[model samples]
Target: MAQWNPSEEYIENTRLYKWMQKLGYSEYDLFHQQSINDVEWFWRRVEKELGIPWLNHYDRVLDVEKGIQWPKWYVNGKLNAYELALGQWAKDPIMTQKEALIWEGEDGEVRRYTFSSLATEVNKVAAGLKKLDVKRGDVVALYMPMIPETIMALMAVSKIGAIFTPVFSGYGQEAIATRIAASRAKLVITVDSSQRKGKEIMLKDELDKALLNCPEVESVVVVRRTKTKAVQLKEKHIAWEELLSHQPCLEIEPMNSDEPLMLLYTSGTTGKPKGTVHTHSGFPIKAGFDAGICMDLKRQDTLFWYTDMGWMMGPFLVYGGWVNGATIMLYEGSPDFPNADRLWQLIDRYHISHLGISPTLIRSLMRHGDNWLTQKLSSLRVIASTGEPWNDDAWYWLFEKVGKEKIPIFNYTGGTEIAGGILGNVLVRPIKVSMFNAALPGMSAYVADCWGNQMENQVGELVLTKPWVGMTNGFWEQPKRYLKTYWSRWPNMWIHGDWAITDEDGYWKITGRSDDIINVAGKRVGPSEVETILASHHYVHEAGAIGIPDHRKGDALICFAVLQESIEMTNTVKETLLDFLSVKLGKSLRPNDIHFISDLPKTKNGKVMRRLIKNAYLHLKLGDISSIENPNVLDEIAQLKRPGQKNL
Candidate 1:
């Protein structure tokens, strides 16, 4: 890792130093110290400084006696998140006519919408929802792609005090049906189809299949994206254009600041997904603040984040960028579409200031070499990464190629539950390879062992000791499950299930998941699910699955199976296993490779030694093997390797 001396010029010109000085902070004081000592004062100051509108003010800013389970924020305030994001800005001359959304398709088509224009569309949509008998607190499902209409639908749902659930367009019909049924959504917003990598996907067809299972869905609004001929609408189905054409653009509705605004589902390993609830005031405020300071986004910046509406990053990008009055560049296509340089071309042509990506995408680009990045992106200022832990190779390549060793790569790590990042790199900090410089202000995070003991410079589970404003209120309709998953592990602390270790220099590195979970290409999966599918095969007796660290994907799934005595393992068998698993567990969950073993290592209690298998495959140092009853099984498996094998 290369370290550069702090430049006085950079320090003076940085966004953090300038904001701190403007906000009446002394130059010698640290941000974290000031924020911790006056937590309420800090948030109250942010609410006022950011010009957030409130219909009524609260007597108290924060009440902590509830132990994060019941954080009484803005005790008496009345305001709607929609009013703050669009209405308040609609009244201001500085932002009314400014371009709020810039939509670019893979086929080189583009569309632009101003704040006033978007507000009109949102108002009409809100009116249409009301006409359809949708009431406050009703759940609305958004099954659209990454387009401007998606943002309008979200704002419309919030305007009417209805909670919105945005599902990813890439999901299959079964996945979509499960979420819609769980949410009990009354209305669904979708498009006819979307183009990805020059191929058309029938989004409306999938929505129809999902709606068949969701009888509660009374109305369906379709947005026409492609010129696919004609389909007669059902009794409850309506064209989006028809709804907006007759309705009048009206004023924004005001509600309590703490009112529920959206429900986003977290991909759980077992059982159904948990619906995480977020409020309007806290989410946008926190997202905007973090975007401005941590990401160093400015008014003149053009920001781009590659994500789907189903993911939290989708809403985060909109709220964070638009609140700062920055131009948000969006694309509804694959990064490698048309050619490998498609993303680079957009950055070059649009002169994007801040570019956000995932480590998996960067590694794929690195394999093609850095020729696309040879051209100087003079307007580029910051590069951000999230979704999964970054590797040393990808981090170094970003700094060298995309940044030309000039711009800093801000690494952010957080979840959908919290609207903002807990740990992020700041502009003032020195850039180290694949590590967060420090935890965000007003957040207290530390690594703890299994017994709830805090440890330094050792691998442990990441836990949060205090509650932050951006934390989710609770899981919708599953408060007990939420408590069991997060707070039950440690009292009043959030156990994030991630294995992390902090160095003496205060840089945090993520090792892997504490639970037996797998992250393949930034998608979360459970080992048990894959193992269950493998065991169903006729030739497989028993199987164990584990994730191995890979440079391309953050991790790759590796399966070890003890075949039945009647079957003989061969190339044909390997091919058959691959095909079966791909169909059963989806392509993303398919194992990278399969290994055949005669006997599985187990303890006297009959617990399989999954750790030993992972260690042997990666050639890493075995941590503890005394618990294994037959450790010799590992040696036998290691010796029965095929030709050209370097390590087991």
Candidate 2:
């Protein structure tokens, strides 16, 4: 069969086609190389193409005086993110009246919003923040569910030039307080309670507890969402309704493009979480550019990404979709709620052109069977994936069952620090199962060996050679730490901690985190490399591979696998599994132990907590596990020790 390329709908009608004409480049490789080789001209054209306004034009596109560690973008340009995202579409009658926000709850509640109405609500929150003294450089935090108001609060905070950070709704007090205090945010937005999977999660109650430790928090804005009894309002607590009852300011503040916009705290291997800072021009512009070119999103499209407000995808979806003038769908509960068809229903109802989700979600749904995925989804032109690398079984299931093998899996990889993707599948190319077509146009990413030499076939570290828009300013108040984290590994290159490989066919695959590369015996292998081999088995749903110290071979591998439902692990079955893995990975690298479990520990964003597994196996202190979604599973894993193992 012939390979599929960018659809006619994209090449014929999208703004990318218009830009291709303007740049006089019909081929993607030529455009990609030019975008990197001439950074200044490329970004200037991109900003203009996106119709982003610059009250004061940039003196230059990039400034490297501070070196790549802190290269300034769009220097001297002044613009509002709200203005950038809204652009000329805010004035269009059809766009203003078009349904821009779609929301549904686990309890059968649904809400839709026109762009004008959404803007009004966002302005009301902005006005309220202004009234509460949330000034231009002040930080406001949101610990809320994936509700329309959650996104509105984010937009409103950006509208007034206040840096906003979001804590996951399911987080405990300690996790919430840690981020709120670290960012020193004065105002917080949250719901009194929220419903998820038919259960009530007390959001405002947890916020109040978190605030007790966060002396920086001066006030709270509460959304009354659940049917739980209303509690008495405290001195610092105010209702969302009360804030919106007042007249909205209806004005956006234009700030310098380089001004801070958000402070998201991501966990590190070291003890504490680092607060990553993103700027006004950086995150929004990069996100929009990725959505426009990679996802081929147009204003006529509707985007629905299964995510929580806490994850980067939440902000990525909102900023990326709107910044490109596409309608966005936000669901507030479990991806699998009353039934497994919930996600498909959203796609069907909203006519989602771009559907973003994680490979873990697909793996989880794959176990539930594809009976619910029977709905017609011709509108889904792109199946966007991130959070983690894909296993063959889950990748094939998603492509065949969900996308009907027609849509491309737009594999993307970057991090909160980048504010957008580094490597991603572009619309111009044909994706090979689970691979990135190329690095996003502007990023100069490459796979290199430990000594900084570029590698071929063999897996190596992923490095970005040139700085791009949306690279975080730095860890909040920790510039030295930021340099040591990303730039210290290599002289000038940004060592992005992830492991990757490029095949002879020019396809790229992010194997796993560089730090996560398990050195068993003498061969270094990424966890995903082994996990993928195991997950390909008919009985294995998902697998977590960890390296434990082996006095015999320097280090040995262990795999904790979540088997398919109703599958029993007999001795014969175990032997068969071990032999199968040996054939795929060779006897020298085959895992010493394979334990079956009900679930694997993961964060809300769906990344496996591999370190937790290693720590548990090594009998080391299990550090801050506040981000773990399923902590109980860790206890189950801790009980499974190899032969002759004592402490475990």
Worst 10 residues of 2 by lDDT: 517-526
Backbone clashes in model 1? 0
Positional deviation of residue 481's Cα in model 1 after best superposition, in angstroms: 1.7
Error of 2 at 185 (Å): 0.7
Count of backbone clashes for each model?
Answer: 0, 0
lDDT string, candidate 1, 1-648, tens digits: 434334778866776767677767635237766776777877887777567778777788888776776576777787778776777676778878877778889998888877888888889888887887778899999998898889888988888888899987876565677778889899998998988878888888878876788998988998888866465577889898877875764755666767788888765655566788888777887887778766778874788888888888888887788667677878898887888888888888778898889899999988888776656688888888887898787888888777878888888888788887888887776778889887876777889998888898999999988777778888889888888888897777889888899998888877778766677877665666567668879999998888877778888888888899998989799789877776555455667888888777887799877777777665668777888888877876555543235674
Q: How much is 205 displaced in model 2, in angstroms?
A: 1.6
Candidate 2 lDDT score at position 205: 75
Query: Could you tell me which residue pairs clash in candidate 1?
Result: none
Query: What lDDT does each candidate get?
Result: 0.79, 0.80
Q: What's each prediction's TM-score?
A: 0.88, 0.81
